[model samples]
Target: MIRPVAVIGAGPYGLSTAAHLRARGIPVRVFGSPMVSWREHMRAGMLLKSTPVASNIDAPQPGHDLIDFCADTGERRYESDWDLVPVEIFARYGQWFADKLLPDLERVRVVSVDRAGAGRDGFELKLDSGEQFTARAVVVATGLSGLARLPRELAAATSDGLSATGPFSHAAQHRDVSRFAGQDVIVIGAGQSALENAVLMAEAGAASVRVVARSRGAVAFGDAPDRQSRLRPESPFGRAWSLYGLTYHATHVRRLPAPARHYLVRRVLGPLGAWWLRDRFTAGRIQVTDGRRVVRARVEDGRPVLTLSGGQGAGRELSADHVMAATGYRMDVAALGFLGHELRTALSVSRGAPRLDAGYGSSVPGLYFTGLAAAASFGPVMRFVCGTEYASPRVARAVEVR
Candidate 1:
């Protein structure tokens, strides 16, 4: 039997990869809800950091880009990079991309993926609906599926049963912040998600919102490009030479020493908010506390209390009605509970992420990963929508050869 190649996600990476595979005339089966994370996890007023031109799910054929989708659907398109793309528009584009190019996508959950038994050399996928299937190759494009990183203090508080109710939640856990109305919210982190969500909480009628960060440096904003500037954009992420290098030479970056590569991935696109978001977050509206870290957290008087300590001093207590941990995700293969024990144990890992080769293939042959899951090997570009341009075709070509 000629088993189909399985793409285990339906987000940007999965849709892009499936489109390329189909264009190559390779039989493929895609599983999962289309754009599930963006639809469920992201709050309604959020805008993508990427520009409209840069945010596209690449297809082998022309005219399937985000611009094409906007033009076709008449969804208020933006012509300039400075214009912020809304999350809702992007989500709709994803669904439209799937409907147009991948009509056979299966909206089903892959309960587990395990290696085929005995002499077999493929994968066995068990679905949630009591069905089983075999695939010649499996591409795990599950972006941020099991990668939510809760802070140690917050995690410990949860373990002690302090967070069983509504006093604590992760940034990725909510699609609406209005529920936090009339309450005090402590938002932790310095990144875009942290800052943006803090503003959202305040706008949603939260009595007070405070942002805490470990860095004392001024929060930076991405500079808008001058229209007539001679220096052209190298990547969709930015016009900087460094960002350009990271985007185009991602595979080369992967070949560098692991330590150096990992450091670049973590630091190159470090925490910051969009230029447009600066005005929304004012000092008068939201309090900003820098150079502080939440060392401990506990429930006191039906509220979450955080013990802050760092550059400012030691043992500062901040009590809030709720804690919104905007701490970003950390990639750990073990967190991907969908992969069976045997498959998880077989692949080599570095820094809790799967180490991939040039084609985004894992240590296990015929097993591949893309999107955020492939960021460890490919560089930071994998974390953004633009990475699909490099990842989809490259992975498809690799699978075709095999």
Candidate 2:
């Protein structure tokens, strides 16, 4: 019997990996909702931080890029992740890619995954539907699902669902920005998500929106690439480049010292918005309180209140109907609760992320990680859609077809 290699996500990395494996005549199964992050998590009318060329999900076959999708569907192309062509078009592009290459893609959530088969060689998977399955190997490409990094102060007030009017939420919670219409909002963090979400809430009719970040000064966008500037070479990481070495040389990145690899992933892409979002966000519309940090948060009178520490002083109090944390994501392997304790314990970790090899495999054989989770080993490109071009084929070859 040819035991299938299970791909645990249906996003860009998941779909691309499965496509590559199938092209190699390796039996594979892909699971999870297609493009859930782009379709539900993002705000309406939000633009992508990446350029049109950088947003493609890779596949082994040629002509499967975004240009082909635009030709087939007649979807209007955009200059970047935002503007006229919203994220909706990109989500549609992912689904179109799935339909074209991954016809048997399983739109289901994996509940748990643990060691299975001889010598704990294979994997046992339980789905949300209570169905059980086994595979020769498992690819953990669960994109940013459990990696949301929320401030401890606001953690108490945060909830995944906005069943009733909510006090706070994370940008990754997939909450609809329209829900906060006519309500005051406080968006935390100094990155693209924070700035863009603030702009989105203002457009969504939030009564008032304010951005409070530990970084100083007004909102700043990254430098656009020009002949004179080499630091801001055009790539998926946007304004950021590989200060350590060649930007896309992910293979070279993995062989570097642990500290160097970590530094490249963290420092290379710090908090900065896209060049195009500059005019969209201004001091007049979304009030900015830079050089401030949220020290404590509590709900008073059915509203979320935050105590600020930095910037001015420690006694500052800011209240809003809701608070949103765009603090960004961290690649922590422990946060992936679906991996049973025994399996997680056996898997090696570095800096809270799975320590992966050049082929994207973790310490445990037959198990692999990709996407942002693989950023620690593969460099920051794993955080973007175009990274699939580099990652998918490597992971496909790494997973054995038994």
Candidate 3:
């Protein structure tokens, strides 16, 4: 019997890949909650950084894009290039895509994935539900799970007690932020998560919110250009020729040195607030303090106390009811606890990310990675939803169907 292909996530990448594979009549099984990251990890009512056109999940056939979703569902259309996409709407879109294209998606989580051993044809998968199965191939499309990066100081402090529950939390860990209605909060990081969530909590009736960043000056925002320029062709990521190459021609990206790829992955299209968020964030509800970093953290009286370094407030100590580390994610394949240690160690890595061939295949045969995990290999585009266009079909084509 030909074993089915297993897709280990239900995010944009996983769903798109599964759709493409299914279109080729390749049997496939997809796992994980649809748009779990966007639905559970992100703050509700938040706006996505990408515009409507840029926020699409790829499909094997046309007419399944976000624009189509809005049109078909009669949702408020965000057709303008500058319109911000709502997180809730995008999450619903993911579910709609899955219902129409992958109605058989399994909501169960994978507990572990391991090589079947010498002479075995494929890999073994153990599920959280206690079911075990085998697959001809595994596409790891788990977007941003276990990849949240907390600073060493914040991590140590959280472990001291709260550990992302009581006093310290990651930006994505705000499952019920309404509980902080009357508490003072301190947010660390300069990115969209920090700036946006601080204002969100404040609007939710937090007593006060302070956003601190370690940059030398004010935090930077990648506001859209006033008008399109003919000098550089526009790309989904931005208006840079390099972004065009990164977004559409990942084959060329694989030719770059590993360090260059890693550098681009880390520095591209990140650590900034959307243009729509600037006014709300700077409206005096939240305090923005740049050029300072959280040097140390501890709990005092069941509250988080952070020590700051640099800026005019050098060595200042601040206490807040809650501390959020919005420092963003780092792709370390080893952090994927679902992979067996031996299987993980067997894969070739470049600076904690798995190196991939042009088709998104890892060093291990029949093992593939997409989305943020593929960022270091495929450039910055892999980190966003639109990358599914460049990645999904290729990964589907790469899977050898018996």
Residue lDDT tens for model 1, 260-353: 8778777776688877788888742988888888899988887889998987468899999999888788889998898999889999999889
Off by over 4 Å in 3: 160-165, 225-230, 311-313
lDDT comparison, 1 vs 3, better candidate:
1
Clashes of each: 0, 4, 0
Query: How accurate locally is residue 254 in candidate 1, as Cα lDDT from 0 to 100?
Result: 85
The candidate that achieves the highest TM-score relative to the unseen native structure? 1
Q: On residues 1-402, what C-alpha lDDT tens digit does candidate 2 reach at each position? A: 777899988889999999999999998889989998878777777877877778888988787888789888887645443433468888999999999999999888888998885665588999998889888889988887878887888775545442234677788774568877898889898888998888888888889999998868646887554422555555554444543243468888788888987886775656888776777787329898888888888888888899998754666999998888898889887888889999889989888989988788889888999898898887877888888989988888877432
After the best TM-score superposition of candidate 3, give how far the Cα of residue 251 lies from its true spot, in angstroms.
2.2
Return the clash pairs for model 3, or none: none
What is the TM-score of candidate 3?
Answer: 0.95
Candidate 3 lDDT over residue span 1-402, tens digit each: 778999999999999999999999999999999999888888887888887878989998998989888888998887677788889999999999999999999999999999876899889999999999899999999999888888888888854543445788888777556777888888888878888887788788899988888886556667565654668988875688888878888878889999898888877776778777877887746877777888899888887888989867589998988888888898898899999988899999988999998788998888999999898888889888999999999998889542
After superposing candidate 1 on the true structure, give the runs of residues whose Cα lies further than 4 Å from its correct spot: 160-165, 227-233
My TM-score estimates for the predictions, one after another, are 0.96, 0.91, 0.95
Residues forming the 10-long window of minimal summed lDDT in candidate 1: 157-166
Candidate 1's TM-score:
0.96
Winning candidate number (lDDT): 1
